[model samples]
Target: MSAAFAHGLIVGKFYPPHAGHHHLIDTAAARCARVSVVVTASTAESIPLALRAAWLREAHPQAEVTIAPVVDDVEIDYADPEIWSAHVTVFRHALALAHGGAPEIDAVFSSEEYGPELAHRFGAAHVGVDPDRGRFPVSGTMVRRDPASCWRWLSPAVRGHLARRVAVVGAESSGTTTLARDLAAHYAARGGPWAATRWVPEYGRTYCEEKLALARRRAKATGLPKPWLDDLEWESPEFATIAERQLLWEDAAARTGSPLLVCDTDALSTSLWHERYLGVASAVHPRARHDLWIHTSVEDVPFEQDGWRDGEAVRHRMDARFREELALRGLPHLVVSGPPHARLERAVEAVDALITQGWAFAAPL
Candidate 1:
């Protein structure tokens, strides 16, 4: 089967990349042999041009389309020829770079009134998909105003970037894992988008176990006694590795999960651990941004020795350090004390309030 056009071009701001944008691209892909989806964004926009293009690429992996990103800061004014020229220059540059030269465009697919003009400029036919927005009644403006309302219209990749991230951090054996799991379960029970809610477990603990196991193996080879967890040495760079891996896990989950992500511990906690062991501030800076933090108190929680704990004293010191750092950094957080059930209740309330407050996006130009 042959396509109607040899090469088709579709251009848009794709502020957030919603279902409507995907529909238009799909429509063009079906009619053209090859499609070039050009994403444009200004410095004033909240979402980056590259990120928008990446999302489109992720959404249409099966389609024969190329995603190109361009940064156009010129104000959008149909009446101003100067502004039009500036935008067209940016678009042409992106197309040229994507094709390695000025490839001939057979058709220009768009949903705006300027489609004909854009096609004429490129000596191509004007192919309008859905000008009335009837097939997919959504726009970038609608998505930016209230993302939750148009949640279904967005792909998992975009949802991951927009989801409300809640980090649960505290001392060892403080029920951080339990709280994170329960929080994810709580939302998953609601079904719908919440059904895919995910929880990121602590990666440092796994790293510790692996390190201790390696030490034990080395001990056995030397005919020495089996090494305990306390025999393991801590290095400044180890904490940075833990922090980096923790964020990677969180990002993977966010891209596959629901609109809410629960984290057992984050990179910030890794810094505190580094200080506790090395007696110095760590170079491991947090790379991911969390929307909210929940501190689990060790008030009534028993320090269960899982064959790899630093004792009750260390737990108390680390708990206090978490409290101090969270306040010192001016991060949005809440401390939940008491029993496991009670702590979960308070965390749920805080998370509910966060969702109710909704996401705030800067107005796009």
Candidate 2:
């Protein structure tokens, strides 16, 4: 069968692209030989224009995607003739850039009422996809108002916009890793308010392991004394680097927009480690305020001997340091102690209380 239109145009704010927007684009792509998706972002939009445009390009590779920036100072009133004319001019320029010329647009695709006027401006047919919205049963407004409730509708890129972070911290062998993983799994299974959850493992441990291995190899090659794990230095600069890298990893995980991000040993833990090992305070602290902080207790869990782990005495000292630092900083946190299962339950309870207390999901600034 022949395509109904030679070229079609789909335009929207796409503040955060959702499934319904995908349906409209996909429908247009199927019926048109060529499709151009214009993502117009105003300065007032919380999400960046480039990010939204990138989502459209990834979502519908078959369509040509472009971003149009609306100046922050301009008052947007589509009904006004002056405003409509200005937008039309911008759309024309964007479309021309996409096609490399003044390509003919035969159809205008949308799920909005303005499709007719837009189509008329281009002298094209208006093809409204799911105007009644019964098929997708979702809208940008609905998704924005309550992202957790509308998690199913959002794309991963947009999910990052609404995700709340939870950090799990404590001394070595304090069940921080296990509790973090369990908290993520618990949220994933529950599947509401936050449709999904992600966990970030301790990056410092991995970094130390890699560096120690390299140091040991160099010692053997040069016939120098074998480097002992105890000789590993924890300087203020190293702690600052670890904290920065940990935050980067957490932010990368957040891009998927999982309702919750469970991080094992965030930058705050690094600060405690720096103070304990080198007796120097961290120059850079974890600046991002997590929605919830779960401090695992070093008491019940037996300290496991690892290549890099300090002894039981060190664990006890570090645990005390964590408590002191947390208190001194006045950061609210829940201390979870006991066996793994019991600790998991307490952490879950704390998160539930937060949700019940109407914890707002404030995306990282």
Candidate 3:
């Protein structure tokens, strides 16, 4: 079997790529040997054009398609030929850049009434895929209004961008990991989209374990005495590395997780940890944002050294520092103390309130 068309074209704002847009792109890819997906956004739109292009590329990695982005802030006026020409100019340039020059487009795929006009401008045939929106029943307009309602219709990349993130930060053995895991489980037990809920473990612990193991291996090779876990040294750059890796893992989880993502620790927490070990403030900064922060209190919690803990005294100082930094930054957070179950209960309530409040998106153009 051979593809019916040599080349196909798709152009849209793709404010936030949804399932419907993917279907249209898939439809074109099945019929054409090559497809060019042009993502055009106005300057007034909130979502970046580069981000839209990246999402499309991620969503259609296996498809034979080129995702191109171009910015156009021209006023729309369907009834005026001059405005239509201006819009076509932008589309043509996008396609040309994707191909290094304009390729003969044999088909234009869309789910809108303007499909025919778009194809005619490119001297190609119009292929409409579910123009009535009967299949996916979703739109950029609907998603922008309340993304949570249309959570199922979004791609993982888009979901990652919209998902609400909760970071649990605290001293060692303060039950941060326990609380994060419990919160994720509470949401996953819902058995719908929530079934995919995910929790990101603290990356710093893993980094430290690996660092200590490497040093021990080197010492053994040279006949030096095995160094204790607490003997591992910390460098300023290492904190930045840990923070960067933490965000990478968190982002990966958010992409596949439910609308609510729980992280055991975040980059902001790394900054505090740096100060605890180095006795000075760190230059490390967080690249990502957390919607809610849950500080696990060391009070009433017995500090159990898992071979990596810095003991009860250090734990208390770290816990106090965490609280102080959270307050100084004016970040939204709450402290959870007492037994594991009690801490879990309070964390769950805070998460419930966050989800219930809903997301507030900037108005789209």
Candidate 4:
């Protein structure tokens, strides 16, 4: 069948693209030979215009997605005819550039009431897709106000923006790693209304293991006793490096579209370890900010004498330190005790509560 229009235009701020936006674009693409989606943003906006454009391009590869340049000292409220006219001028210029000429728009596609006026200005027909929002039943305002609650309406890219970080942290042999993995698995299996879950393993553990291996290689060369983990003193520089690397990994995982990140350990825990061995807690490492913290209790979980681990006394001391530091810093955290399975349940409960409570804080640093 011949297409209804030679070229169709759809425009929105896409403040964070949701299902409704997708539906509008898909509807336009179906009726038109070619569709151009213009994503606009203002200086006051937090989400980048480039990011939103990229998301639209990825989400609808068949459509030509373009970013409308930010116009200074211009209001973006589309209800105002003056503001709407300014946007139309910008979008027309952008579309012309994208098409390499005065691009002819056959139709203007949108889910908003301004569609008719916009189309009339561009000398095109207005094609409204779900103006009542019966199809998607969501809006950008709804998603922005309570993302977790409106998660079902969000795209993976949007969910990435709304994802929450939950760090599982405590003293050694406190089941922090195991709990982190389990929590990730639980969320992944549950499989959103939100995006999938991601787990970040302890970078400090990997760092220590690599250092221990290097020490072993040196000992072998000298034909001497292999150095114990205790022989090497923890320094502020090493802890700082570990914290930096941990943050990097966490951020990388977060960008992968997972709405929930279960981190095995964060920088604050590393700071506690720094104090334990180095006798001073330097604030050089960036504080790992998490929406929720699960502090695993060391009492029920047996302290395995791993080659890298400090003994039971040190474990107890570190446990106390974690509590003291958390309290002093006024960070919110839940202490998960009991057996492994029970601890997992407690951690799950806490995470669910946070997700249900809805995102209120700013995106993770």
Ranking by TM-score: 3, 1, 2, 4
Write one digit per residue (lDDT tens) for candidate 4, span 147-236: 766777777666656689998989989998899988888888876543367799999889999998998899999998989887775667
Comparing candidate 1 with candidate 3, which one achieves the higher TM-score? 3
Q: Kindly list the per-residue Cα lDDT of model 1 for residues 223-289, writing each as its tens digit.
A: 9999787677899989999999998888889878888999999988999888888899897696767
What TM-score would candidate 2 get against the native? 0.77
Q: State which candidate, 3 or 4, has the greater lDDT.
A: 3
Q: Any idea what lDDT model 3 has? A: 0.89
Model 2 segments beyond 4 Å from truth?
1-7, 29-36, 42-45, 57-63, 71-105, 191-196, 233-258, 275-289, 299-304, 324-332, 338-342, 356-365
C-alpha lDDT score of every prediction, in listed order: 0.89, 0.79, 0.89, 0.80
The candidate that wins on TM-score is 3
> Which runs of model 4 end up more than 4 angstroms from their true locations?
1-10, 19-65, 69-80, 86-109, 122-138, 145-156, 185-195, 218-225, 233-237, 255-258, 287-289, 361-365
Instruction: Name the lDDT value of residue 47 in candidate 2.
Output: 74
RMSD of 2: 4.4
RMSD of each: 2.3, 4.4, 2.2, 5.1
Can you write out model 3's per-residue Cα lDDT over 128-212, one digit (the tens) per residue?
9999999999999898887877889999899999889999999998889988888899889997778889999989989988898
| Model 4 residue 135 lDDT score | 79
